[model samples]
Target: MNATPLVLAVLHPRVALFELGIAAELFGLARPELGVPWYRFETLVAGEAAAQAVGSLRLTSDGDMDAIDRADLIVIPGWSTDAAPPPAELCDALQRADARGARFMSICSGAFLLGHAGLLNGRRATTHWRHCERFAALFPQVRLDPDVLYVDEGRILTAAGSAAGIDAGLHLIAQDYGSAIANRVAQRMLVTPHRDGGQRQFIPAAYPQRRSQRFDAVLAWAEAHIAEPLSVATLARRATMSERSFLRRFQDATGLTPMSWLSQLRIGRARAMLESGDAQLEAIATACGYGSPESLRAAFRREVGLSPAAYRQRFRMRNAPGAAAITPP
Candidate 1:
């Protein structure tokens, strides 16, 4: 990687402003307090010098297709799914970028542009849930995972929808820097720091958060006591309901069962610990209620698609104490 990577955001016609905003907020804005080399970001339009955007807004692009040759990472914000195919020139530039090993990322409908470039032929990718059917039909060879917030196939990354762009952008930040830096960026943005990419985009919440006070309290209590061995009976007692009733209500409030929710919470905590500290696997496992390092490794791999050790190695803070002495599991 370059000392200061250049991130070029491609702004095609009728680009969704929110997705583009996500790219700019994440990579374009300067962060002086981060004390690290930040990305050099530019917005490029395919054709004209000025473009019309949603909400009757006009934007003068910073660069053109020629900028792609100098970019280390390229971002395609939401594209027009119904509009004509991207210009042949734009597609050719993307193909060249791919051949030279530049990373590509798409937000929501932007995956359509990638598909038009023939970049997602056999790779795993995703888009907004609303467009999954059409995207799958349009490109049957692409392994479409509609459930995930984002899919990171290494070189090509795709986000689900509007807000999911934030998650994917932070993920890229985590990749370029580390999870600690990503979490700091997310804190500045007032958003949750590290939502795993494999987490489901849609949760079947029969009662929306505004209407689920009792549900919220239960969730808070469970999270506060995440290190304890929790079960249906214990949670049922806390909620003052029968086990079956609590289970049904919990399933309705969250799309996951009691145990599944607890497991995800434990894994999330374990991930935070690994990213911010230099604790050993055995200690991290015990603190996260996994009982042993082997158990933690098994659950971490099953849920996160990477072992705890690997995740720590990939995302651990660089300046942490004892970081140099810790060996991989």
Candidate 2:
């Protein structure tokens, strides 16, 4: 029998409980029937033997720094943003494990610990947006990307904040097991299977719709007439404003240019059509205003990084409830 992979979660002082919980939920669960070998998870606490979480919740670990050397994957949960540097022993252990090919990952502010250990130098990483500035200032060599939810640079990974940790963990599972198994795990956890890591962290919860009532009306009209060759001039004429003024206001309200927003909408529609498996590529392209199948392919490849046929193959729900036309890639 093959040995199960041992995932060691190294807990730092004042670790965020929620980040630790996510690791435990994903790695600690035993699902042998899923056709994947079991994973052995051990929580290792550093410094003072025991640690207290946010609400004075004390956690005692059965393992210590030694576990890092034997781990197949090392997970650093969130650490205190205000705390001093990590100890030399922890840093050395991490460096040794990394040298020996053990994967290292961080969730939220735990990225600071990895940064301090010199593991993130010259790598693209992210933390909670609130701490991104400080993280960059502290580790100038590391390329800090604050806008995205997470970043995966093969062996090293970093996530943004609370819920983003879940996305990062699910991505790791997807890399270890195929998408189908990852989707099954996500279903069991009641979470979205895949959220592109590059998606914006916060999309402005309240978009102040009342302030842009006229713009909203114009947007609705544009959506209704996607097939029509609508231009900025046409939209400005409909709103009874100069083209320049309309362009500026549209960007300020939507954070995207009119053509860019239209392309996104068209691609969204194209994706739905591909998943439905009923519409031909050329028909879907015309319906979504791409004018031709070649245009749709170009737009889909640019936006989604995959052709429409590939996207359908990866995401279409096979054995969908309703009996729809099933087109094989």
The candidate that achieves the highest lDDT relative to the unseen native structure: 1
Local distance difference test scores for all models: 0.83, 0.81
Q: Name every residue pair that clashes in candidate 1.
A: none
Model 2, 1-329: lDDT tens digits are 12677888888767678899899888888987698786789999887678788777888998978899899988988876754788899999999999998997789998999999999999999999778878988899999988778889999989888778888888888888778888888999998987642423142112223246768788788879987788989999988999999899888877788788787777777776776666788898888888788988988876666677877776665775878756542
Could you list the CA RMSD of all candidates, in the order they appear?
Answer: 11.7, 8.3
In the range 1-329, model 1's lDDT, one tens digit per residue, is 89999999898766678889899999989999999999999988777787688678888876967899989999999877764788899999999999999999999999999998999999999999789889998889999998788889998999988788899889989988999999999999999986654433142212223235777777788777777778889899999999999999888877778888888778777887887788899888878788789999988887676778777776775756755754322
lDDT of 2 at 111: 93
The residue-level lDDT of candidate 1 at 141 comes to 91
| Clashing residue pairs for model 2 | none
The stretch of ten residues in a row with the least summed lDDT in candidate 1 is 201-210
